[model samples]
Structure formats: C-alpha cells, structure tokens
Target: MDLEPIWLSIKLAMITTVILLFVGIPVAYWLSRKQSILKLVAEAIITMPLVLPPSVLGFYLLLAFSPNNGFGKWLHQHFSLQLVFSFPGLILASIIYSLPFMISPVKAAFSHLPRSMAEASYMMGKSKTQTFYRVLLPNIKASVFTAAVLTFAHTLGEFGVVLMIGGNIPGETKVASIAIYDAVEMMDYHSANSYALILFAITFIIVISVFVINRNAVKSPFE
Candidate 1:
C-alpha cells in the first residue's frame, strides 16, 4: 500500500488545522461579541461552507485561481503564483471549506463565557488583547481543541473540493480520499479498501476524542 497519499492528507490536515486555530480564534471572538447586520452577514458567509456543496465552492475557486482569469492572471504575472490544480490551491480551498468547523465551537465557547471575566481583566489594566489571550482562551481551551480536531478530521476526508481544485497529482494533490476514488475507478478494491479503512479508523478516533473532550468540558466546574 502506498502510504504517500495518507501522509499527504495528514500533512494537509495539520497545516490547515494550525492555520484555522490562529485564524478562527480571532474571527470567532469577534463574531461572538455582538449581534448586528454586518456581523450576521459575516457569520452567514463563514458558516455557508457547512451547507454549501464542495463542488460549487471548488468550481468558483477554480475559476478565481485559473491563470486564464483576471485574479489568477494578475497573480501569475505579478508573482508567478499558480493556485489551480496545485498543492497551494488545495490548502486554500481546504481553509475556506473548513472555516466554520474551526469557528463554530470556539465561538460557542466564547459566547458562553461570563462577561465578568473580561471585565475583571480590564479592571486589572490588562489590554483587550492580553485578556483575550490570557484569561478567556484558557477557559475555552477544550472548545479550541475540539474545533482543531474537527477541522483536522474534516480536512482529512476532503474529496469534492480538493478533486475540483487540485485534481490528482501524485505526491502533490493526490491525498488519501482522491487515491481511494482512483483505486475504486480502476477496480482496485484492495487499495481502495485499505485507504477507506485507514481514513475511517483515523476519523473515528478523532471524533471519539472530541466527544470525550466535550463531555469533560461540560462536567468541568470552571465550565
């Protein structure tokens, strides 16, 4: 069995999870703070991927990043960056597709937190930034972990969006999910089953961990 595809999927998931951790915290924090028309709009956009078809997102991204189009053409001419059907393109699409997974749980955690926490931190002369990082984030660590794990797991099984944007480029965009599809297409059930079993085991473990984490979080006195 070629483990390259599995390794590639793991690499992509790790990178995507890490990036979402940093990016999601700030966005989730902002979204949790208040309710407004603009916030609603932003939240809707962020959460759209949860329901949006991966192929649709992939198609738009493909057009946006295609060298034949304006945005892609500009990037190609100015910086010689090509995203479509490339590894970088896969990373970008994954990030967008998985944004809500990283943000929703963290935002829920943040919203459930007491206002007194931030207020007390402010009274102590801590900057909003400092308070958010030090006081609030510590309390929501479990949620953050859940979000990260969910994002990692989601990215690991990505198929439609990745296939549309990255296609199958061995050792590049040929992740485990795509490899499974190719194997099935060629009637190589052994390889396909191997990939499926591995992915199923990995995702199952990750999901179980999330449930355990959430259960513990709910039982924690601090929560």
Candidate 2:
C-alpha cells in the first residue's frame, strides 16, 4: 500500500548506477588494458561480489560500520557519517553489490574494442583523456549503457544486503524489495504480489530495452 519504498528503491538504483558509471569506467578500463599479475587479484576483488552471498557481505559490512568498530567510529568522529541503518548505508551496500554488474559490461566493452583505435589517437597527438572521449568511448558506449541499466535493475532487487545494513526504514532504506519481503511476512500475499509484479515489470522492460538498444548499436554503421 505504501509507495514510499518503491520510490526509495528507484532513487537508490538511480544514484548507485550514476556513481558506478564513473567508478566502473576507470576500473573497467584498467582491467581491460592492464597486464600485470596483480591485475588478476584486483579483478578478482572487484568481481568477488558476484559469487559472494549478499548476506555474507552484508554481515561483514554491518560489523565494519558498527559504531563500536574502529572504522565506523572514525567515520562518525571525523565526518559525522553513519553508514549503518541509514540511506547512506543502503547506497554503500548497493554500490558494492552492483559493482560487477557495471564493471563487467564496461570491461567487456573495452576489451572487445581494437587497441589500434586508441593507439592511433595517441599517435595523432591526443591525450589519454581525449582518446577516451573521442576515439574509444563512442565505439563502446552501448556497453556502458547496458552497464547502467543492469546496475539500476540489480540495485532495485537487492534484499539481503539492504536488509542487513539498512533494516527497512520507511522513506529511507525501505526499498521495494524489502517491502515485498515485509508484506509476505505479514501474510499479505496480495501486497507482496503487487510489489513483486511491479518490480518484475520494470526490470523486464529495462532489460528488453537494453537488448534492443544493443542490437541497434551493433547494427548501426556509426557504432
């Protein structure tokens, strides 16, 4: 019945996807190009969330953000930022949980491109930044678009991590996933089905849109 949770989930997904675009781009670029042995370790770290259970990650995060813990204490003392049981906590958890969704697509995008494009740009007196914007990004923009949509959808469906860290706080951390969970717990199948159906519809449409756009991009001569 309360729509606040749905809006909150949308807000969380949007913000998380936007931030991950910037963060994931650089990381994905690095992973795609770097050849050092340490790069393997770094990639594993970034992709760890994909295999790790959400509740496991959430449990550790909860401890890491507990006020009694050193890191949490430092955060509160210096920046007055409380990560546990707050909107900020949900953001942080979602970011971690959704990192691979954004990064993998971007990495694939960059990896699939020809190195000659970047090399030619460098030879033509373009800086790395310029090469990225002018020569590289345009060719692979579809992957980035895919990453954004995937991240948004993934964040919207999060439950265990958000629950462990944010605890279903209405108008704040109580996202649609949590709402469905609560509805089911209260023996309200209708409410649960409504939220679930809405989430499914939104995610389905987003994914279908991404596939359509990707196909078009691939078919386009400009791409």
Q: Write the per-residue lDDT of candidate 1 for residues 1-223, one digit (tens) a residue.
A: 9999999999999999999998999999999997999999999999998898889888888999899998889999999999998898899899999999999999999999999999999999999999998999999999999999999999999999999999999999999999999999999999999999999999999989989888987795866
Backbone clash tally for model 2? Answer: 0
Query: How many clashes in each candidate?
Result: 0, 0
Whole-model lDDT per candidate: 0.95, 0.91
TM-scores for all candidates? Answer: 0.96, 0.96
User: lDDT score, residue 218, model 2?
Assistant: 71
- Most lDDT-accurate candidate: 1
**Model 1 stretches with alpha carbons more than 4 Å out:** 220-223
Angstrom error of the Cα, residue 18, model 2: value is: 0.4
Residue 112 in model 1: shift from native, Å? 0.7
lDDT of 2 by residue, 1-223 (tens): 7878888999999999999998999899999995788888988988998999999999998999887798888999999999999999889888988999999999998998998899999999999999998888888888999999999999999999999999977887889999998999999999999999989999999999999998998785866
